[model samples]
Target: MGIIQNIKKNIIAKAMDKRKAANPFNPEYSDNFQLPPDAAEDQNNSHYFSVHDLKSRQSLYMRLALRGGSAPTEVWFVYRDGDGTVYMNERDHISKGESIPAAVECVEGGKKLRFTYTGPVKKGRLTDKGYVPDGNSGDTMVELDGNFSGLTDTFEFSRHMATEPVARALSREKFTKEFRAALSEHHQVHYEQSGTVTGSLKLGNREIVFDKLPAFRDHSYGKRDWNYFDRYVWLVGLLENGDFIHNSLIRYPAVTEIQAGFYKTGGKTLCVKNCTSMDELPVTGGVPEKFSYTVAYEDGSVRRVSCSLDFTVPFVFGGGTYFVNEGVSDFTVDGIKGRGITEFAFNADSSRWTRK
Candidate 1:
C-alpha cells in the first residue's frame, strides 16, 4: 500500500509540472506558487526617478526607499540600451534618515558605470505648487551629467480618494488618520513633471549630448509591501513633439485602484481624469508584451496610446517579480512617436509564472 501511494504522488507531481510548463500565464495555477517566509507587511516610502534619451538610445532609472520594517533604506540603479541589454547596481543602508549616496560606481570586466548626484534637492523642499527637484543635477553611467530644471507643479490623487472615506477604509489601522495625514502633509505621495533635461549619455565609449529631454519624478509613502498588491502596472512616456503621459494601476484581492497621471503639452500640464488600460501578457513568462490605454481629461478630450516592448530588464524583489520595459510608444493625439519606460509587478505567490 505504501509503494502504491508513493507512485501515485510522483505521477501527480509530474503532471502538474507539465501543465505549468505548457501554460505558465494561466492564473489558475497560481495557488501552487509559494512566497518566502519574510514576505510580511510593512509601512514605507519610496521615490523613483527616470530618464530616457531617444537620441542616445539609452535609458536610466533610480529608486530610493525608506523602509518601515526590518529592511533598511535602499537604492537601485539601472541603465539599459535599445537592444535590451542592461547593467544595474544596488546599495542598502541601515539608517532611514541617511541621504541618498552622492555617488554609485560599478565595474565589470572592462566596462565601468558611475552615477553621481551633482546637486540634490534637500528633503521637505515642498513649495505651494508642490515638491520640485529644482536645480537637481546627476550623472548616470559615467557619461550622462543630467541637469533637470523647469519642474512643473506636483500632481496628486483626488482629495476625495486620498483623504476622505476611501483612504480611511484602505488604511484601516490603529493610526489610520494620522498615517494618511502624514502621507500628504509630508508630500510623501506625489509626482511632478520636468520640462527639460540637459545632459549627455555614453554608449560604448561614444558620448551623445542632448539639449532637452522631457522627464518626470514620483514619490510614495505608507504601507508599500509588495505583497499588498496582487499586481501593478506603471507607465510613463515622453514624446519628441513635447507631450508627456503617466499612469499607474494597482490591483488588490478585493479592489482595484487607479492613479491617473498628468499630461503635459504646449506649456500646460493637466491631470488625467479617467483611464482604461488593456495589457497583453506573454504566454511563458507572464510579462507584458504590449499595452493599450486611453486617457480622458476634464475638458472632454481623450488620447489613445499604444506601446510595444523593445528592451526588457526582469527584476525580482522580496518574493515579487518586476518586468521593466523600455520601448517606443505612439499617441493618437498627433501620431507622435517617442521612447519611454514601463514597469509591471506581480506578487510571487500569485504570479502565473511562479507555478512553473
Candidate 2:
C-alpha cells in the first residue's frame, strides 16, 4: 500500500509540473479574464472586496451578489477596527446603482476598479457571540470612496488545480467524492487578486484616508446556491516581505479538503500543493477567532501562517440557513507581520455543522 501510494503521488506531482506550465498564472491577470457565457444573466455572479491597513488596524469588507431577483443584488459592508465596528450596511435593501453602488466599477480593464459606496449602515458592536447591531444607533450614512489597483496578477483557482482529476484517475483507491465535488463547486471561473486601495472612507465625523493600503478581491460567477455548500475556509494576506498568500480549503459532504489559490513572492506565483492545520482552530461562540495553517507550495517551499482575529462580521442570512463567519485579522508568516481576511462559512443543513 505504501509503495502504491508513493507511485500515485509521483504521478500526480509530475502531472502538476506540466499543468503549471501549460496553464501558467497570468503576469497581470487583467483584461484577459473573461466572464462566463451567461454572465449577462447569471443568477449567482458575485464580486467581493476587502482592504486592510496594518498601521490603522482598520479594514473594509464587502460582498456584492448579482442575481437579478427581487433584490437584484445582495450587498453587505462592514468597516471596523480592534475595538469595534464604525458602521455596517443593511441586512436587506435594493441598490440604486448598476451594482451595489459600484462595488467593482472597472477603471482599467483589469488593473484597477472604482470601489465606492454611499448608503445607510448600522453601527455594530462587539459582543461575546460576535458583532451585532446596536439598534439604538439609527442608520448612519456612511461613505466609502476607494480604488483597487492590482499589485499582483489575478489568479483563477481552477486554472492551477489541473492535477486533481488526473490524480483520482491514477490512484489505487477511488475517491470519486472529492474529485467530483471540488470540480462541481468551481465549474466556473473564479479569480482572486491582491492590490492596493487608495481613497478615503467617511463614517460620520471621522474619516480614514488610505494611501495605497494593501487590498484583496475576488470575482466569481455562476450558480452560487448556499444550499449546495457544506463549509469552507479562505485566507488572503499581504506579508511585510512583500509576499502575497491567497488560498482556500473546501469541504463538501463525503468529500475531502480541496485546495486552490497561490503563494506569490518576488513577482512569481505558485499554486499551493497542500494545506494542513496542526490543531483545531480556535472558535469563539461558533466563529473561528484564530487560525493557523501550513502550506506546501508547488515550488517545493513550505510556509506557515497564523492569524489572530481582531473582529468578525457575523450575519445569518439565506433564509436562516447560512452563516458567514467573516473575520478580519492580523496575519503573521514566519514572524513577518502582516494583515488579511478570512471567511469561514457554515450551511445549516450540512451534517458537519449540525453535529457541531
Candidate 3:
C-alpha cells in the first residue's frame, strides 16, 4: 500500500507539471497565489476607494481598513486643494451579545437609497494563513463619499438591521446566531451580505449607482503579539473611468510591509508583490504616499495612474498607526488624464471606511 501511494503521488505530480508546461499562464491554474494565510500578513486588514467629478473639478475618496481590538478603530483622509480640502473617513464597531441592525436612508443626486444589515459580525481574529476574522458588531455608522453638493456626512445606522418586522425579529438574534458567516462564499475572502445597499452618483454626463456589502477585518499584534501579517486590500466596481485600487502593508507588530496595485479599464489587474519600489509619503510618516503606478494588460494596452495628497488620513491602533494623504488622483488609462479624484471618509469611531 505504501508503494502504491507513492506511485500515485508521482503520477499526480507529473500530470501537474505537464499541464503547467502546456500553458505556463493558465488563469485556471493561476490560483491568485497569495502569501500563507497564517503568516502575519493575513491576520486583519481592508482597502476601498471611490471617484467623483463635482462641478468642474474632480473629487476622490479612499479608505484603508485595519484591524483593532481594544476599542472601535477609525481613520480619516484630507486632501488640500485650491477650494480648501476634501476628506474621507472610516470606522468599525463590534459588540458581543446582541446583533444591532438599522435602516439607512441617504440622498444622492436627488435619489434616495434604503439598505439593511442581514447578519451579525462573526469571525474576529487574525490567522497566519492570510485570512482575517471579522465580527458582526452591528453596524452603527453610515458614511458617504463622492460629490453630494455639500460637506460629507455620516449617519448613525444599525449594522445589521432588518427591512421588515419579521426580518427585524430575526436580527435581534442574528448576533448570537449567525455571527460567523463566511465573509463571502467566494474563496477570495471578500464579503457577502443578504442585506442590500442602494445609492447613486452623478459623474458629469453619467449617473452611477452603488450597492455594497461591508466586510470588516480587525486583527491586532501587540508588542509581544505574533501570528499574521498586518496588510489590507480593497476592490471596487468600475463605472466610466472607475478602477480598482489594491493597497496593503504591515502596521502594528512589525513595520515595513507594503503591497499595492491598481486594476483599470477592462482588462487584467497588476500588483506589486513587494513595496521595494513604492515611494513612501511624508504626510503619513511611513505609509506609501503619492507614487506613479502603471498597469499593463495582455492585450497590449497600458494605463498610468498617480495619487496626490491633500490630507494626512489617520488610523491609530494597539500597535502602530497609518495615515493616507487624500487629494487629486490622476489615472491615465491608455494615456488619458482626468480619471477622477479619491476621497477617504470615516465614521466617528474611525474603524472602517463606510461605503456600500
Among the numbered candidates, top lDDT falls to 2
Clashes of each: 0, 0, 56
RMSD of 2: 4.3
Least well predicted 10-residue stretch by lDDT in candidate 3? 153-162
How should the candidates be ordered by TM-score, best one leading? Answer: 2, 1, 3
Ten residues in sequence with the least summed lDDT for candidate 1: 26-35
lDDT of 2 by residue, 180-263 (tens): 465555465578788888998777787878898878788876656565566777788877777888777665544444566688
Better of 1 and 2 by lDDT: 2
Strongest candidate by TM-score: 2
153-182 in candidate 3: lDDT tens per residue?
111011111112212222222232222231
C-alpha RMSD of candidate 1? 17.8
Q: Estimate each model's TM-score.
A: 0.59, 0.80, 0.37
Q: Relative to the unseen true structure, what is the C-alpha lDDT of residue 184 in candidate 2, on a scale of 0 to 100?
A: 57
Per-residue C-alpha lDDT of model 1 across residues 28-64, encoded as one tens digit per residue: 1211222233533354555555677666655666665
* TM-score for predicted model 2 compared with the true structure: 0.80
